[model samples]
Target chain A: MESLLERYRNLVVLLAILVAQIVGLAVQVRRTSAGVNTLDSSDASGVRLIRLWANTVVSPPERLIHSGFGLFAGAWTNYIDLRHVRAQNRDLKQTVDRLRLEEAALLEDARQGQRLEALLGFQEKYIYTTVAAQVYGTSGSDRSHVFYIDKGARDGLKPDMAVITPDGIVGKVRDVFSHTAQVLAVNDTSSGAGVILESTRIRGILRGDVSGRLEVVGILADERIHPGEKVLTAGGDLIFPRGLPVGVVEKVVRDPDRDAFIDVMVRPAAHLERLDEVLVITSTEPRFSPQQQQDLSVSAAEEESVPAAVKDQMKASEIMAEKLPGLIDPNLAPDQQPLHDSSNPNPVVQPPQPLHPDRFSPGSAPDDVPEPDAGSPPDAQPRKPSALPSANGGSTLPGSNSTPEATPQRNL
Target chain B: MALLGADLRRDLEIHRYPLLVYTLVPLTALVLQAWLPRVVGRYDWFDLPLVITIYFALGRRSPIQGTLMGAAMGLFEDALSHNAIGINGIAKTVVGFLAASVGIRIDVENTTVRILLTLGLSLFSSALYLFVNRFLLDLATEWSWLTELLRAVGNALIAVVLFPLLDRLQSRD
Candidate 1:
């Protein structure tokens, strides 16, 4: 038996190695299968030790090389590339000027929208805090489309956090280590997110195909999807926030596997192949714009200050104004309009007071009277008041010191 | 205990390298494999670890050593990647054993033979990888014969340039 073992030792060793590996593979496959049901759970915990070792072995050199390249690139851009600076600056200045106007218009529109949203009591998820990470390496296999970022758990990164660029979303954090994290690109076959077509409002699952292309599935074949329509995150996956740009529809074709479904190919907005820097969303909060929040607070305060009966009266008046436009003369100023109470036969007319009674010295002008403007037309001048009969049958000017015994009413 | 016949063993010329070459070459290959693609974009056609595995396995001319070397390289490659640890291990171990077996009988020092061998082994490894991923693991893998062919050709071309540079690392003693 020993002699036979010696003779076939090499073959036996090969078989043993292969069998061991096959078993390991099977174990991993089983674990992965189990983990798939819990979509947000970390996968392959058994391999974490190996992954950690590998990362420890590989990360330093990669960081060093990346820094070296960055230094050179920084020098090139900051010092060596001065020839285009003046022209670039000029163009940037022009862009800033144009953007300033556009921003003003957009700010106003956003405020108006936010005010309306506050009125409707709508809440939305917004990106609250993000950590900037530099992409220094990848998984190094074409089959696995993942990137390693410089920031990780130490930098407040966590698994399943969304990674994005200014252009659009890139992917999500798959695994987080102390100093580095793995980002599964959206184009990875295992990666998926809930997405919606911007124009058509059609939602579907965005998945990466075998060839690392983004494809939207689960849309009906009859849906009128056109190329160049925008795609955005639906936020149902709980990984990416809703309404972040995903990509644009590149093409729509009938799915060969599913007769009822059509596959929509997407051109990713973020350049997944050539990513350098990414932002990992660490936390999100439901929020409104600052102006909207202020408006909401003011509205709440106003509602709190007014009594319910007064509110009802104001609402009734608004309804009445809407129904009878002729009730209040549109031409007359608000204070100049006659106040008529339907229950009372006689209405009291309040005279318009002086614009600046404080400006006049004592006895220089009547406190309740407005001085006539010299430049105004004769018709625009304040008319002198005729003496009215008092309760005692004594004639007295309306502004005179003698007080009326009862609330004075004007005969129409 | 000898797996090969004495006559066959007599014909084989074993090549040796400094210990640093053995350690650093594979390490460098793994590092560069992970790093270069990020700087140069996703040029997945070339694989440095596979090239290093094939090159060393061919030169060593010992089935046992070659198999062990391949397994180590493959495992490290898998470790560096997001793949299961043993997937590349199995494929590369087979490549290593085959390359060494073929090395003993043929003049693998010949440039044409080296290119052909590298090309053939690359395709074999890719096929094994696909089989494992699709059938055993039930993973979705994009398979294209044309792309595989191009990748093999690309590895062969890279081997042509790399093998000669690596030859200088051999210990004359």
Candidate 2:
């Protein structure tokens, strides 16, 4: 026991350690009470100060070890922050793109009505206007340019009617249902429209070519036409109206006198990929007979033949019905009909020049015309005929003569 | 002046009090050492400072001596760790006292026995620390049981290997 007492003298080291721990405990308690994590903050501060002092007073090895540890940890944190920043930047870019698209759509919608007013050259003369639509997506699988329009087929849309953005001609309507119409974009490769150059009055068949441009070939090479000339629709044959923009000459490759033809390439005015709402042409075709065609100088539907201009007049009653909706026959006046039945009255006898019902109406649209793949627009979802299938299916086709005598009296 | 000279001679002879290392060493490590640094390189458990402390401190003369030694190690740990300051201090002190009491009563002079005893004590202490933290205080510790066991084993081996040398140093001083 006496020997043990001698050994107890060595416990001074232990006593010092205990005192140090007790001091640490007290400091931590005070900090914790103040709602601070003293163990973390206080210890970190102490460690940093101690390390700096040790580097000055203690072995260099110890200082090196601490500094190396800190650098490694800091580097790891930087890597994590960099990863998070990259993901956030990608998200921000997508949001900016979406906002710009929305702005373009709103502007396009406002411009459509104004454009029609300008084209008519009379204030509000061509009255029944179209709603603006924007192309949402594309289907790479089916290669369809099905666009989503603000106005559906309900807004007086018919199959085969032309579609064009303000940039210029787009395509004609392939099919029309109650709430949507699938347009064949200008670059669909399966497209042909009549186009004539405004500068040279050079009429040609504007076919959408494989090079994704327009090829306007005139039958008569004798017609002196030049490149860098603007093309407009020569609407005498009533395909597209005269003075509608087709395209400008990109390159003119003139062939030395071959057949009586001048072949020229015209770049399309519309960018099909970035399609928005387009002008769907109202058909103004006159029922021309075979003898009438024989007498005409040009057989092409696009060439402007002189017309005996008749004084076109409208009655006050016709104007009133147009002002008050649902009074005119939709089958006769494609613009006046509502979505449900259009309920336009006596459209068969309404048009001053009535088309032979058999000649004009294509009867019913084939059900097998696969619902233009929705890979393009939400409106283009494949044919699901579960609801109102009968009412919406082929009930109102373009040029359908609705002789009001047989039809029900619907409220205007 | 005579008393002060005597005290200075005693301290100089033993080279005992390393106040900077004992008090501030753990504090510095705590701030600088990242909680979860990249595991690309190897982590040698023997190199851990806490294991070094245990190797030196457990060779203390009595249970009280071990307890005090443990408190120093614990305080350093608390300063660095983002946990309760006194928690490690109390836990380590108790482990020290238990180990010292058991060691003094046994044939601790046998190196093999000393190594085994140190190994067992390290494992038991680490388990006890974890249990007290998780169950009593609701503290979080990660990694699987197998990995934690391996870490304890490494620390124990280090302590066992270094204990005799540290013990001799203390006695020589």
Candidate 3:
């Protein structure tokens, strides 16, 4: 009887953990389902409003916490501050790197805009707007690589809204409430971006898997992609606008097998680990062309002549193209992606399809794994909750780099 | 109000579940010493709720009670913290059990022995908590030997001093 009771006691304890786990997993699933069902844009806006009200209400407590965090950082910095020049140099160095990146991005944007304008024979029009958010807190234990922001639905933020730090793309809005949100970083196993190799016009997909590593896929046989080259979004399909700096190619390994594709690793353009401020581009493409030496005066003169209404209209469309995925497919009931009639560009579009690698999608990876027209993410070996959940149970995870290999389903 | 006496009675009853005295005394002390003040602030760097569970839950004699109670506390804390629902609860329950069972187990009932045991348990549990919570999850964690030592010694002293009073209260009842 005593032994039975002891065994029962152990069972009860185990059951407690099991029950909690079930509840946890259930909540994760329910939230994900909710995310899938809702219109992410409006959801972000609502979240921002809630965040503002809550922020006002909780100012005292929030300030206390913030001050405490600041104090901790301050204490650490105090020691570093003694070496003022070093700190300044570090900040200066980072600033210098940032300015250089912006210079390059600006130059690239100008060139791309020129090409696009020439191709379409349309007047080059660009729009620039941004939303600034101060990162509040992050889920330290979140293997999902999610962070919290002070901005919420009311703050004009919505789920699916892209987030970036000063350096570059930080993440996308995952879930949001009145005054706060969870942003999923590009380093998570799920993020896939349309990237083009700067050196070789070869395009591929940039896959962010568990290891905080990025890879390029879909390079054609004739195109030779090398390491240490730059990778940027081709803005293919405009899921992300073209010209946002992605990362630099770190390694390029050629397989010995005749038909095997090359392996290209990329170091992200932004230093994701220690991130502070970021810019949320409010529109697709830049509003100002590299003011040509000849047109600078004429454009400056004409800039004041444009009516405010036209600017507003341009802002609406620009924001829609850059921020909201709604314009791409207006008819489909949101939450039901397949229900939406997204244009497939071409029935016979050549390479570089940067879509989410969901085998569950109606057309499980199309026949040739569309070679990207430009910057492509390499076909990762296999990954976690986003791409391949099965990999978690299979092969030995790479040591010191246990990046999940495409997990398609995460149980909360 | 759920009747302060009634809550007190419930809490008293709560303390009787096999090995709860050892858990409660230390938890109460640590909460008072380390986490109580942090509760007033929102989003403090240290996770007070996790601290409460780790410091209190595992030190109990009955691992079952420790884990279950820790889980309950975790759930309540999660709601208060406005976290992604059950994340805190789940993490707490796991931490509680591991701390109570495979965690640094000690059987020192004497005041001095209890204090020493409490300190050792606290140190080891905090380290374990850091490992699972920070290292594995990649969340921001500040793992300092001094902080761990301070929390451990502080909690142990409280347990050693408080448990006897609790024992006396139980005897009178």
Using lDDT as the yardstick, the better of models 1 and 2 is: 1
Tens-digit lDDT track of model 3 for A228-315: 6678777773556676678888887563454567657788888777655454554554555556544877876787788989979778
Q: Which candidate do you rate higher for DockQ, 2 or 3? A: 2
True A-B contacts kept by model 1: 0.53
| Most lDDT-accurate candidate | 1
TM-score of chain B, per candidate?
A: 0.90, 0.66, 0.54
Candidate 1 structure quality by residue, lDDT tens digits, A223-252: 557898889999899999989999999999
Which window of ten consecutive residues has the lowest lDDT sum in model 1 chain B? B1-10
Compute the lDDT for candidate 2.
0.54
Worst 10 residues of 3 chain A by lDDT: A403-412
Candidate 1: lDDT of A345?
67
Model 2 pairs whose backbones collide: A47-B27, A47-B28, A164-A278, A164-A279, A328-A344, A329-A344
Local accuracy by lDDT, each model: 0.80, 0.54, 0.56
User: Any residue pairs clashing in model 1, and if so which?
Assistant: none
How would you order the candidates by lDDT, starting with the best?
A: 1, 3, 2
Expressed as tens digits, the lDDT of each residue in B43-122 for candidate 3 is 22234444445444433434565577566555544333333334445555665675455323333234665565466655
Model 2, span B82-123: residue lDDT tens: 566656665676566666555444445566766666666666
